[model samples]
Target: MFYLTSGVLFLLVALSAPAYAEQNLLEGGLLLTAAALSVMALALILTLRSLARRNAKLSRQKQSFQRLLAETPGIIAILDKNLLLINASSSLKSLVTEQDHSTLAIPVPLFADANGSIDLLPEIRQQLKQQGIWHGEVWLKNEHHCEAFKISVHNLSSHQGKTSTYILFGQNITKFRQLAAHQQQQQLRDDTTLLPNQLLFIEQVRQAIASCDEHYPSAALLILDFVVASQSEREVRLNEQQILDIATNLKLLVPETLLLARFQHNIFSILVPPHLCKQYNTIFLNQLAHKLIAGFNQVDSQGMRSPLRIYIGISISPNDGDNVDLLLNSALKAANRASEQSDSALCFADSANQQQAPDFLAMEAELYRSAAHGEFDLYFQPKFSISSNRIVGFEALLRWPSPKRGMLPPPTFMPLVEETGLIINLDRLVFRKACQQVSYWQQTGLMRGRLALNISIQHFTQRDFLRYLQDTLTEFELAASLFELELPESIFNHPTIWLRERLHSLERLGFKLILDNFGDGISSITQLRLFPLHGVKLAPALVKYIEQQEQQRNICATLIRLIGYMELDVTATNIETEMQAYLLHVMGCDCQQGHRFSRAVPAEDIGQLLLKENQLLNNQRQLAN
Candidate 1:
């Protein structure tokens, strides 16, 4: 408009000057100059009006932009060329506690590396300058903790023309990050036990193996499983609840520092630290396996009190195999071998054993056939009473007479028996046969007093175990007071409420309970308080160690005194020397059993030995009188 007005004024002045040229040259010149001045004045007025309109429009746009910045959900900021904050939205300012925006010239430490370091600001600025834009996710350190944010920035020229500015926007992504972390956590844990699953366990073992050296020597892998042997290849396995119960009990036995994992339905794995492996030898692991079995035995399977049999396979790193899969395989193979043995219940992996893997299914078939025939025999180990100077009781031990393999010990086929559910039948047969022998002795006046019978946790925990025992005794008309049930120390590992109640019921029903191997595995005096135990059988290890080590002697002495205070009878087992016998007698042991008394013998041989012992006792009594 100013230019148009100026042009029109000049055009009119030029046309009038041509007309006035004839009147006077001087006057025309003055008129032309006045017209030029008027045109200049008009141009100035139009320029001022245009400037006012443009400034009003710019003010309205600034107000709208300010409102948008305030209402935005995320952080919005303007930073100068030096990465200094020129303007920031309220949302951006709310990140900090201070409300003073004046002191906020420099950018906050919101843009960060994955490790939450704010040292990447210079790199971010350089990138923005080179590429005109920068965008990505960054970690931000909040007042209390760190947060995640997706930041975006664009270079812009500032209105002042003094410096360049950056338009920055940041979106909070903390919840997303938390959700991702939770998903990762879920992937590494077991659903039932809430412990780490096999994947994590394998990873831990792999790391331990890789890092193993002279300074950080060895680690051990222990694989535990409950064998369910059947006549067929498809064995009868434990149900989900039974497996869960075993896992729960195992958790109680394992320490918190060690890693435990559920490998399969009835299998669990433990990662033993190098230090522990060095500290504890195979003996300690065998004891641990025994303790685990005892703890597992307390869980009732399908209304039965005895828990399923658990086999532990162990393989030390470097010694067995260095890698995860190889070590796991070796441990599994050793566990299979351990399943064939009854004592200790653990087998360490070795190259020789790995070469000869046994056929468990065939063994299971052989066991079933053996039980079907009357091929199983019972041997008696006499419990000699030091006070009475006679054989007061005998512990009934089972023996399998295999046509193809001669006499098989309990460890040879007992695990298979339990796995095949044949323990229920075999245990009943043993009890009935033992009671018959007792009744014969009482009728013939050959022997007297209680007969102690070893009961498998599997058979003992049966819902009908008590009924079966009562019926067997009644069938023979044997006095319940004359019968004693010897339970291994493993039974005390973790007795459930129901198991505790059943044990008390056994006492009420006239069955005497003897805690066998009292100091072995996880058994302690606490078990004595929890159950209705009439006697305790001191572990053979304690008696043997006492003879060799003074510390062991003191420990045994303290235990004997403790048991004496409880008023429970004590029997020391595995006494092979007169020195051991004399030491036990001085320690106040009521009875002793082992090679010194007699090795387990046939029922007929036991009867003759008892007769000889009774005659000897009578002569000693007469001499004393």
Candidate 2:
């Protein structure tokens, strides 16, 4: 209104003033001077009036803007194109508790931490100057605080001649970020039987592989599925949800450090650190394969086959693919190869994998047929007491008697057995064979040592497998103390409760339990507290160094002392040379087992060797004499 009145008065005065007369000099001068004075008064009044009106508008807008800024959700602020908060709302104001400001605006970096990397102000300024917009996410940190935020700011010009900045807006977005983190956490399968979503599992694999460069890493993706997995048998209901649940349960059953993801309905991706692989065991990977099948067969209480009983396939990083997509694809196809015909897991390693699926399928069919026809046979190797040079036990080793391929080691058909799900029966057959041999020896007084049977990580059923084992022992009439079981380091992969119960039962039945290839498999040793054990097998790696290297000797010596202190027996495996045996004797490994004595042989040969024990253990007689 003031500006309007001033503008009207200026217009009236300009109209009323007469034009300067051209002919009369005095009159012309007088008229021009009057017009100039009126014009000057009008201009001054208009300037003052315009200033007053602008002030009134500012006062109103300022109150409303303040209200809006204060009430808005999250932290909102007006920043200079430099990200220096020219004005801030109450939320941003509260976050800036340390700084004393009459008004609520400040620099965003004030909230950031020392040592935190920030590409904030310059980037914001550049975006604002060139595009007039800035938008993205940023992480801000302080000694006491750190936060993730989403921000957006726009460039604006002020009316003042000075390049004045407009304070824009901001919202904290902290809750949204936390929600995202929570969602990411759900990828992990918990003991509560919660299945990790597919997205979460992939992230875990990527994270595991990412650390491969700096730390221990190797992955064996085992895809368990039906050997003859057709669409379905007419009576067999394909409950996808239940199958997924079973898989999730299996994942939860393993150790926390392991990453378990459902690669597909009948496939699982297990990212195992190379050392954790039981392949390095003295018993080797084939024996490990047998053990896994035995354990997996117990997944159900009734006789129902578990959905988790799928084929096993593995693909390593860089060798399979550097990234997840290519690696998973290759692994899954290998799993398919194992599934379609039944060969445990095939690594995407060689030209043979590139061979058509049909060839592998036919190959799987033959392997299963061979197993069913009793193609595998058992061989026994002796374990001697390092101090006594007395035979204390024998490990039952497996052989594949192939008609076409001749006598093949367990490694030859073991992968195929795991793939075909025939290992469960194979374990049973091997155990029975070993039991019969031990029983035969005990009856004839030809064997002095116990028979050691290797156990699988998966063999502990919630139901009583120990009872069935006892029945077998009774059937064979073998003394309880004469049977021992060997377990690989992967036993830690099982649930604590199940393992504890099974071990207790075995102990109660008087069977000794020993760990095979101890130091070789663990990054950090699995706590012995979780297990009931009689002895441990020092891996060949430890024994190899015990001879020539003082450092290795020290390590072996320390390990022996540690094992002795706990009152647990120690056996050094692969005692290939007399020097290794001497070291074992000096270091106090309770037993020594390897080729230095004899190659693993048939049960009859073992009986003959036992008959000549006095010849083999002359050192003991000398010590006694």
Candidate 3:
């Protein structure tokens, strides 16, 4: 308002002065001077107002910076060229002692050395001077504990382009470090027994082997196979308590200084150091094995005699093997040989026999390479309908033609495949091949029947199994009805609710489900009724002697009748002779698949077989007419 008034008055005086100039020159000059002074006064007022506004803006920016430093999550501090504390964030105050705060230097709590000396500060400063930045992890002393901080220090330059101050940034990494340590520990432990797992055990073995010298030239590896004696050769399932009890017993028998680990579900391993091996001889090992067997022979908590049998296999380093994998494998091979013996419960790896044993590692490597190169072939065995005397379908079997071995059957490689969890990949490969063959047959009109695929229980129960089936079918432009999934009878071992739902999902997708290898295991009629099965395939062993033995024949006939009464399509497998086929047909088994009809042939040979069958059918029709 004052500036406005002055400007108005100056303008009015200037206008009036021009008129008075002619009358009184002196009076007009004075008026002009007064107008000039008023103009200067207005300019000064405007400059002051502009300066005031700029000062207010700087004030607000300073307040905002102080607030940011106080509220920040991490530690932030500023130090002068002499390393005296110039400013610190609220977080930094928590780590600084009262006496240190009074000194105004870098806080002592930030140093992790024994005497609370800032030994790292000189190095940090040197790095900042050379590179303008330094970053590292440092341990900081908190109130009751030490915390890890990832610290970053930057050189702040002045207007003269010289380092004038330092800016320190710290992020607390205590929780992250703890979490990483926990995860590393978890990787070395077994989830069930809480013992060091295979990875850790292998590392320990490697270390022990490397530590061996002339004084202690050998280490001992013992593999204990805990087998439950039963009527059948099927795998024995032991509950968690039983497994723990077995582990506890082994621990008591063995010394605490030795390393023990669970190699597999029913297999445990012990590693004796080289010094111990030098102290104990073969006789000592034999006595220890006997002690383990005798200790487990006593009755159980239920007051019944324990059926657990212990087979301990011993392998010595520098004799059986010199490395971790070789030694472990030698022990495993010895354990397998011991399990086959009926009288003895222990076996030592003999160097002579070791030469004849198969190199499982080489076989495993070859199998993996073959699978990668698609060296596997599928052989289709035709399933004949006995009643109609026509081809109903074909069961697809996987065959590996190894370059070393002439032809390897499923039994030779499948156990290893399943053990290594490679069965999932093989199962997918088989499914795709079967779908492609079926699609080709449909396109050429060569044959018309469903193709049965034997799926492993692990692969069949996968969460993506149904989706994979749908995708493969869609890719081949084939219907699900053209495919049949032959699941093993062991699939019934899973929870009934989950198994039923999974089977029903497959059924809903239009694929037929057949229980494969029926009567191979101890499957009951009650378990059979719980599944949504379209058919059942008799295990070859169940009907192997049906032709000669009357008792076996009666049992086969009864099983066929019982299955027929259940309204299921029964297929008898491995029909090697005409008598077996005839017997099965007369016994109400309409479907038969075995060597008697046709051996498993390649996909290309299938077309010729179908053509021959068609020609035979045409000739029969003409004879009937």
What are the TM-scores, per candidate, against the unseen true structure?
0.53, 0.50, 0.48
- CA lDDT for candidate 2: 0.65
Candidate 2 residue lDDT tens string, 134-191: 6776655554556666767765664332344654555566688778766666645532
lDDT, ranked from best to worst: 3, 1, 2
Clashing pairs in 3: none
Kindly report which residue stretches of model 3 are placed more than 4 angstroms away from their true locations once superposed: 1-358, 618-625
* Count of backbone collisions within predicted model 1: 6
Number of the top-ranking candidate, with TM-score as the measure = 1
- What lDDT score goes with residue 606 in model 2? 70
> On residues 152-243, what C-alpha lDDT tens digit does candidate 1 reach at each position?
98877543333487788988888989999778778988777777888888899998888777755788888997855444534577877777
Worst 10 residues of 1 by lDDT: 352-361
- Per-residue accuracy of model 3 over 579-623 as CA lDDT, tens digit each: 998888888887898899899999899889988888989998999
lDDT of 3: 0.79
Of the candidates shown, which would achieve the greatest lDDT relative to the real structure? 3
lDDT for residue 99 in candidate 1, whole number 0-100 = 73
Candidate 1 Cα errors over 4 Å, as ranges: 1-202, 207-318, 322-349, 359-361, 418-421, 618-625
Predicted structure 3, TM vs. truth: 0.48
Clashes of each: 6, 17, 0
lDDT of 2 at 109: 58
